[model samples]
Every structure is written in C-alpha cells, then in structure tokens.
Target: MKYDFDEVIDRHNTFSMKWDCREIHVILGITPRFDEDTIPIHTADMDFRCCEPIQRALRAVTDHNIYGYTGVFPGGYGQTYYDAVIGWFKRRHDWDIKAEEIVYANGTMEAIRSCIEAFTEPGDGIMITRPVYTPFTGTILKTRREVVNSPLVDREGNGFYEVDYEDFEAKAALPSTKMFLLCSPQNPTGRIFTDEELLKMAEICRRHDVLIVADEIHGDLIRRGNVFHPIAKVAGPEGIITCTALNKTFNIAGLQATNIVIQDPALLDTYRKNANFVLPNPFTAAATVAAYNEGEEWLEQLIDYLDDNIDFVIDFFREHMPKVKIRRPEGTYILWMDFRDYGLTGDEIRERIYEKANVMLESGPQFDPERGEGFERMCVPTRRSLLKEALERIAAQFPEG
Candidate 1:
C-alpha cells in the first residue's frame, strides 16, 4: 500500500466527537457509570488519516494565510469543483450528472433535512427500514414528519437481512406517505440493495407518488463482489434525489462538503429554494476538488485496509466470542454485531462495554428500539492493533461465551 493506514495520529484535543466520550454520552443520552481511557469505535468517521492529496491541499490553503469569502458557482475555482463532482460519478458510479442538477450542501444530514422539508409536509409519512442509521429517524422526527418503519426480515441463521417487500409496498401505498429515504449498502445490516430490489422499490414509490431520497454517502466504500445500484438509475430522475459526499470516502468530513443531486428541474428549483441558506466554504471546496481528482488511489488502498480490518474483527469474534454473531458487510467500514445469544438487553451490552471493557460503541436501541436491540455498531476503519484491543476488552468481560 502506498499510504499508511496503520499510522495513528492523536485526535484528543482536536474536538473529535468520537474521542470525546463524555460529550458523546451526553449527546446520545448514555449516562456513564465509570470514566476511564476509552477507545471509541463508535460514530461513522474513520480513525485513519485523510488522503494525502486532501491533507496537502488543506495545508496549501492554510499557508496562503488569506482566508476570505469566495464564490462557489462557476467563479474562480468553483467550476473546477463542480467538474470534479461530475467526473467522479461518471468514472466511479457510471452515472452521468449535469452541473445544473447538482446542489451544494454543508453535509449529508443537512441536505437530507432540506429534502424532508422541501418534499414532504408536516404530519406526512417518510418510509425507512428499521435497524437503520439512527439519524434517518431523528431527522424525520425533528422535521415533524411521521416515521414509517418497514422492518427487514432477519434471515437468522446467516445473520444477513432482506427487505420485506410486502410490508414496504403496503407503507408506500399509504396516502400520507410522501417520501422514502433509501440507505444503499444500508447501515448496521450492510446489505447492498441489488438492482432488482431497487427497481421494486422504485415501482412501489412511483405508483404511490412518493419521492425517493437515496443517501449514497457510503456507496464508494463497497466491498468486493457486491454492486451498489444507484436508485436514480433504476427509478429514473423524475422523483429521485441522491445525496453523496467526499467526507466518507476521503475522510475529509471536517471540511463539511456534500453534493445533493436532483435530476428533475422543477424539483431542483423547489429544493434549492427551500435550502437557500446554504453557503460554500472556500477551503472545503478546494479540498473536495483535490479529493476527486487526486485521491482515488489513496481511497482504493483505504478500502483494502478497511476490508482486512473487518475480516480481523469477524475472526476474533468467531474464535473467542462465538455467542456473538456478525454478518459479513458488503459496504461501509461499520460492522453490525448481533449479541442476542448472550441474553443481554441492549443496555446491558452497553453497560458491560462502557463500564467493564472501557470502549465506546454505538448501542443497539439507538438505531431502532425493536429491531436494533441486542445489536451493536462497530466502526472498523482504525489500525488492526487498536481494533484487536477493543475486541479483546469485550471478549475478556464475556469469557464464558
């Protein structure tokens, strides 16, 4: 590998949300019983360094020492930024995108909120699969929209999951259901929606006049043998809005850059009008251009390392903690672990990890109380040594397993 993914830089004083356990607990409402040095394997951000190209670009910007307001659309370096975005989709995802169809937002979540606000009305229903990324449900509730959860079937023996199409269609057919937020290569479960699945979902939404919001933020991190089918390609552009960002791929999330793609002109006009308050950051724009143009090789290497780390975690669990089960992930660095065999409630698992193991992991219920219980989300984008330490700590506490 050309890049050093094993290198660990100190993030303690960097105001990292993951490293700051006290703050994370306060935000997530997990009161800590004991405080000690803890390794945070929670949150989606990686422990690895940002791609070299992006770091160099940010350093160059800092060296210039002249930070002032800069234009973002077709002015100065803005066109280059836009072209990078277009070129990336064509090169990576095979989706041809136009400049006018792309709108800039500060981040994926911010863009999602804007879409919820623009496309759906208060008290309207937004459809999602349970044991999904928590923020999907949180954003819905925050916007005063009702959350319509279509729970995925467990496929128990293999630890894999599948959508219950029957239930999904039933929810979409509802009169108040206005939109569906599809998390491709979905969080927690890590199942990449196949093209057939995508088409089926598109069919249901179209018949019910529901708009589809595809959150493909983790699309590029897909594992080997799995294909990430972009919803717009199957559903057509008429009622689809796709959100993506370089933050996850290149690890430049602190820069706050995301692209919200809308193919329909009339819908684009409405979304932009509703999200009019968004402003572009000059440094982040520069970093984004650098990432798209020069960071592909680094990204490729990072994915390889992340895949290896996932394997390590799975092997460790199977050998030492057989009671705990994991379904091999198809995309994203986050691994979903099922601990139902341990006979522990979600809070009990959280307590053991936080109080005894001294590691911070995302509790199951935070994703969905019913479906997410007895499951934990572990971020595995760190060095193998650190990852092993976290696993060892947890295994030591559950020795009988």
Candidate 2:
C-alpha cells in the first residue's frame, strides 16, 4: 500500500494507444460500436503509474538535458545496466546469465520478429499456440513464415489451458517447422508453463532442430501463489533465444526496450549479424537500470494489488454472472472469459460488450480466428473503482435468466 494504485490518473489526450487512439478500432478491424463512455479494459498495458524509481530515473535523464545519441556502455552505464539485469534474474528467478550473452532490442515483438527473420527463412514454419497474443501469428505471417499452430487444449472445458504435448511434438516433427515461439506465463490464458511442460516442449523442439524463442515478457507478472519457470532455466541455454523486458513489468511498454538472451555463441553471432541494431535511448537506459534494481518493492506491491483485482473480478463474475466461464489465471493481469454459454455469436458478443455494456474488451476471435470465439480478454490493471464500474456495467447487460 505504499504506492497508491487506487489513484485514477487521466490518460486521455496523452496519445495513449489504449485510450487516445480512435483509430485502434479500425486497426483491430472492430466496428466502431463504442461511444466515449465505454470503459476500455482491452489492452495489456497497465493504467497504474510506474514505480517511483523509474520516474526518478527518467527525471534524472531529463535533468541532464542533453538528448543526444546514447550508446549502451557510454558514461559508465554498462556496469550498472548489466549488473541490474544480471542481479534481477539471479535474485528473482534464480536464473544466472552473462552480460555478454545479452543483446539489446527495442521491444518483445520486435525481438521476436528479428528472431524469426534470423533463425527461419521464408516458407519456413514457426510453431505457436493459438488463443495466444495475436502479434505472434501476425509477426510470423508478416515476415512470410508459415504459422504452425498447435492449439492449447482446454481439457476440463474451462478457460484454463494446457499444452497438448502430443500435438506439439507432432508439429515440431515437421521438417518445415524451424522454430517455436514460446510465451511463458502466457498472455490471455495466463497459464504459467510448468518445468515439466517447458522441458517437454524444449525437448521436442531440440529433437527436431526447431529453434525456440521464449518470450518471457510476462514472466514476472504471476499471481502470488504460482511460480514461473523460464525455458532457458529448464532446458539449458543452448539454441534458445529468451526475450526479457522491463516494459510489461513496470507498465513502461512505450519505452520499447528489451534484452535478447542468446547463450549459444553461434546463435548469438547469427542474431547480432541479422537483427537490427537497437540503440538504447538515455531515458530507456535509466529506466531499465532503475526498474531492474530499485523497482522490486513497487513490483511486489503491484502484484499484490493485481491479485486483489483478479479475486474481485472472479468473485463478481461468479456471483452476478455465473454463466460466464473464467478460470483463475496463474500469471498476468488478463482474464479470459468464455461466454459461449450465452449462445451468442462472436459479433453479438462484441455488440453486447461494446454497445450495451459500454465496455471495450478484446474479442476472442482476435486471438484465434477459429477457436477464440465467444471469449473475451479483459485487462484489470486500472483503478479498483473503475474495474468495479466496468464489471457492473457488463453484468447488467448480461443478466442471468
């Protein structure tokens, strides 16, 4: 409770993609059904203010006042940057990595794109689990690579998803499939892959010589009781490209900074030569250092607040809208709610949420064009009052018979 998460800061007119971008609807191919009163709980970014240390770091950068080209190691930033990143992983995740193995990237998606380009050629297959972050598929297709989807299984008929190892191995065995994009502490479903699961997937990929790019961007945002295992830690460091970033952890996605960890010397060299060189801006460097080092207290508190928020949503839905199927996610602040019990089409569901409830949520179809129907993803990092209000509005529109 040191940081005021309840404080509702206005993000309007801030050029925020979630709040200010009217063009987002068109971009997402969503019909403009929402009015100005619609509460947006769609995007993955947090509405909460970043930790104080990050703010202080940025302030220091501005105080210095010379916005010039900044190198990674210039002005003694190398040791601090490396130490913060190294210390954080070691201290928090118990995963030890070297500074030399880390490559700078602008963002997780950008890093993934670079990995796809560097590791796989055009017409090559990049395997991914659908009902996932849409960007994974988009990036693969945009780069002219084949998207080999081995859909996650919802065995219990609940929202919780598990990797289908049989299907995964079958897909990995494909001669054309050259890489696997792994989203640990996965988005949407928020299923934190267990060590067993990570190992099984890694073994399959390794057996088939399919490279693994583990996007651990959401790795640190787990629920209180759950543990997250990095793929590199579980499957050894060789031939695995792990992408880590402070953006999602600190609600600093706009900063566009990420570290690509490639422990294999040859793979690292290939990535460095193929991937675009991303220079670290002064603000980004300061924020990264501060976030990895001094932002833990704030992050812990934030996780606690998010846990409460998740509980609130679960309880509210169970009481007011029992037909809405949702499982408690192990990680991330997203709730994947299944509304198929209502017997509404995806378009109807969209209309009900956007027009009737005046709540903007991510439609299921956006994640997986086929299987993601009648589902919606809601992000819960806003003020509790706003979240409550949005839930109430949604519940009113979808009253139980």
Best prediction by lDDT: 2
What is the C-alpha local distance difference test score of each model? Answer: 0.85, 0.89
Across 1-401, the per-residue lDDT of candidate 1 in tens digits comes to 38887886777767776775576676677547425478778878888887777878888888997788765685465789889999998898898998778888889988899999987889999999888999999999999999999987876667677888899999999999999999987887888888888888888888889899989999999887777867887668888899988888887777778998999888898887776657667778889888999888998888889889999999999899998889899998888888989997777888888778988788888877787788888988888888989889999889787
Give me the candidate number with maximum TM-score: 2
Candidate 1 — what's its lDDT?
Answer: 0.85
User: lDDT per residue, candidate 2, 328-394, as tens digits?
Assistant: 9999999999999999998888887888888899889888887999999999999999999999988
How well does each candidate superpose onto the true structure, as a TM-score?
0.96, 0.98
Per-residue lDDT value at 6 in model 1: 85
Looking at model 2, residue 376 earns an lDDT score of 92
